[model samples]
Target: MKRTLVVGVDGSPESRAAADWAAREAVRRDLPLRVVHAWLWQPLAYPLAQNRDAEARLAEDILKETEGDLSHRYPGLTLTAEVLAELPVPALLRAAEDAEMLALGTRGHGALAGFLLGSYGQQVIAAAKCPVVSVRSAHGRPVALPEQGEVVVGQQGGVADSSEVLRFAFEAAAAADAPLRAVRAWNSPPVYGYSLGPMWSADQFGGLEPYEKAALEQALEPWRLKYPEVEVVEHVEQGGGGHVLLTAASDARLLVVGRRVRESSVGVRVGSVAHAVLHHSVCPVAVVPHP
Candidate 1:
């Protein structure tokens, strides 16, 4: 179980793009790359000739093609390809259990439009043992990352559980030599109003904004000191966390979100904000599970 970056590929343009992203990421981390494709055999009612053989060949073909292209593109990089006879979610989860990070395509072949990430991709993201990054096809974004693009992360008021997410974002920014934007979203309590006048006007916020700004700064202070070379930007906005993070990540290189682990739950526990961003982020999205 040597450290490696695992990518799920299925011969689609989106998966290929994810593989490309993972290759570059592997190079960045100086780790080996593992490309995996999952295939399950379905038993026909009458069982004429089994298509299992053909499907297995196809899976091998996809794996080999990906391995060849990646090897050529990233010379001197260690890469392995595997075709697992298991369902996509379980297969990917197992492969990623020992990986530094798992990279997945936003959608698969014959994906329905309007869904930011396909169903299979979502399941894997919700269950992966390591950090999972959802990457879109090259055409999903412009050829060049936007000039204002940075590694944006949702700061959960600098909670102890969010340190992993913030650290991941800062490291990514440092790797890209880009800035890290920490966004903290807050909402003020609503006040009952009368027809004559509106209740709880802007003045009622009463230093709440400053308090949020201070909290954001305090959460980021240690990260800033540790990664002094990485420029840090703090944004405290008034709105739902999901919307704030989505808007800020529009031009970002990567959006990192944290998932708090709940022992009472049977599987990984993903919050509403993390779920929202996973379904709508324009750039690559990373989900880091934290206790």
Candidate 2:
């Protein structure tokens, strides 16, 4: 069976926006969409607890409401809804195992707000097997993916670390018929520490922007060949990665970034760039895990 696109909803405005975004993505990918809600049972004695059946009914109601809205919006789109009797993190991760991608609602405030505010969202994104898209609403409504604005993706390191990010960005741009903006940021080398013989050429003493731009183009050449139809705009700037990506994606419909999958006894790491963009990006952000 084909993997479906899964989206988690808790009836918040941000979640509703995610559902809207996911539905459109499903249409674009020609994939089935699954709308899910995790319903963890709490004891009746708990302060905010209701009866078990009432809680279950409420969970089902949330799914029903979202399903109804999305079904009405996309008449021909294949959609399904379910309520999982488990906690949010594991439940969504399990659902994502068989999914093409997972979409979640995120707030556009400080680093500690929305689904991403705590460990819940972080856990799901770090541990999931597929790409996770975090979406935010604008002015109390879902921001529609722009047709003209480019689909921006941050490229770092090399093709090995950023292949998945580039692939997702190219496919998204192709699907939306929009341009793809590939951004690479760099910082100048320290003035005193280095031998200039091997690292710097005679002409490079003046500046390194040309070399940085060339490296960026080299990293993107293969992708450009593969996606010949995608109009790619290469952007190389001198600054921090997160700041440069956010600025380049200011008018973007979607921002794609790579998260290196790391296993640690302490916890999963979302990386500095991904973390920064997740906290502040104005458009929807997709975190693609890569080696």
Candidate 3:
């Protein structure tokens, strides 16, 4: 694994917290922390009317200002800061490609209270090229992954593909010493199976509960194959995906989910699953980008 760590620094209190957390992660993982700040400049209708040099300078200043506490707080972690003129997400995405893990703070957008992921953290988690760790500003002081807590994987069974997800999930499970619960949610009535037609008997759906449970076992196959030493607690239930994940996240340490992969494309899809978890999970979420 690439040992370099990357973090998004946006001059907000949350971003500052993220830097502190990221530094601690670097120290824990024995890696270097690369702090990145992105700034966007609006253009005029006619063309390059106003200058962006000033904006760039201000962005650089913010990066410097964000480093205030690192010398005293995180001296051992190697810190590198850069200012990009592009949008936050893409800039951070490029940074993540070379990083083993990307750490970020949860910043809220809507009027709702508490420390939820803001727009920037949501975007980064969705499309990051590597595992992106979304840290809560109000929790986990040192920013390390939980040593003894739940590691819940948002499993949707066959709907979500790839053993990579399970691999990442189990890796977290091993790291936390927390029992891993492979969660797969199923609800009544097909959400969009219009062409499949209706079922004949309620007993037909009776097998679904068992089938879902078996699917969880099947999903665990590759994970077990890779890491037989890691023990997992399988959770196959019927409910909404986001709700189930969040409910399972209660007092949990780390919630792991795969970045939604498109059918034909190489990049990730930043879909509702990611958005929902990023904006709502009480604990930090680890978004494992599809490889």
Candidate 4:
């Protein structure tokens, strides 16, 4: 099947907001949009077929309504809706395999009290093959990023194979005609004091600041050249990765981060930094899967 921007939707306002966000992104990328709703029917003691029919109808209604609204708002946008009789996470993951990106909605930032990520949304973010954007629902409406805001990207501060994430961030900024804020963090190793070497004074460690700044600049140089129109802002600071990114993304239209795809003995492994931003960012968070 042709690639499209896929959105996972339910009847909730959060999911509706996700669908709306997907529509806008699809328009930006000039791609088709697909809305997917997954449903399951619990077995009843009698008339199991009736229960299944009711569940299917409800799922269909959700898809149809979302499709209609999006099509009306965005005329001539290629659209398709599907109702999958499978588990939410697995179905969304399957849909994501062929999608340019998968977007879903959440209640709010997890750092706030009484805010928790739905199990299915968390599972899809951890395992989806493509980039996944998580948006929050508030005021019973779709949360839209400010049109004039910049796109913030978190990096590891050196020139490495973080090209996929960087490219996505740059392209997004270029598309929106907004600045790209590249944020990198630096910190002393956790074992600094316990190391064999003698303790170093603050003055002795002050020289590292320039090195970190140079690394961030070098890492962003080529991308800057490639997208000359995009204004680049580099922020190199000494702090925890997650906190640095969270603060940088506070005024961003979208926060982009990389996720290295790895198969561990336990299961899929997501970096702590990406996991934290996914849960806490106020704006939409895009987790780009990298090899």
Top lDDT model? 2
- Per-residue alpha-carbon lDDT of model 3 for 154-271, expressed as tens digits? 8764634746677777776664455887788887776675333333333455666776776678778877877776777888778888888888877677788877555336454566
lDDT (tens digit, per residue) of candidate 2 on 195-218: 667257524745567777776787
lDDT tens readout by residue for model 4, 126-234: 8999999888755645566566688999887347657788988998898788899999887866664544442333335555576677667878888999999999999
Ranking according to TM-score, highest score first: 2, 4, 1, 3
Clashing pairs in 4: none
TM-scores of all candidate predictions against the true structure: 0.84, 0.89, 0.73, 0.85
Q: How far is each candidate from the true structure, as Cα RMSD in Å?
A: 5.3, 3.6, 6.0, 4.9
Predicted structure 4: lDDT = 0.80
- Which candidate do you rate higher for TM-score, 1 or 2? 2
Provide the lDDT at 117 for model 3.
44
* Comparison by TM-score, 2 against 4, better one: 2
Candidate 1 lDDT, 1-291, residue by residue in tens: 568899998887777878888888788777899998887776768947766677678778988999999999999788999987787788899999889899988865722121124777877777777899987644454133233579899988455757888888888888778888899998865554333232233234456687677777878888888999998888989999999999988889889998776644465547799889977777888998777
How high is the lDDT of residue 37 in model 4? 80
Q: Residue 159 error for model 1, in Å?
A: 3.7
Worst 10 residues of 2 by lDDT: 108-117
Question: Which residue pairs overlap in candidate 2's backbone?
Answer: none
Tell me the whole-model lDDT of each prediction, alpha carbons only.
0.79, 0.83, 0.69, 0.80
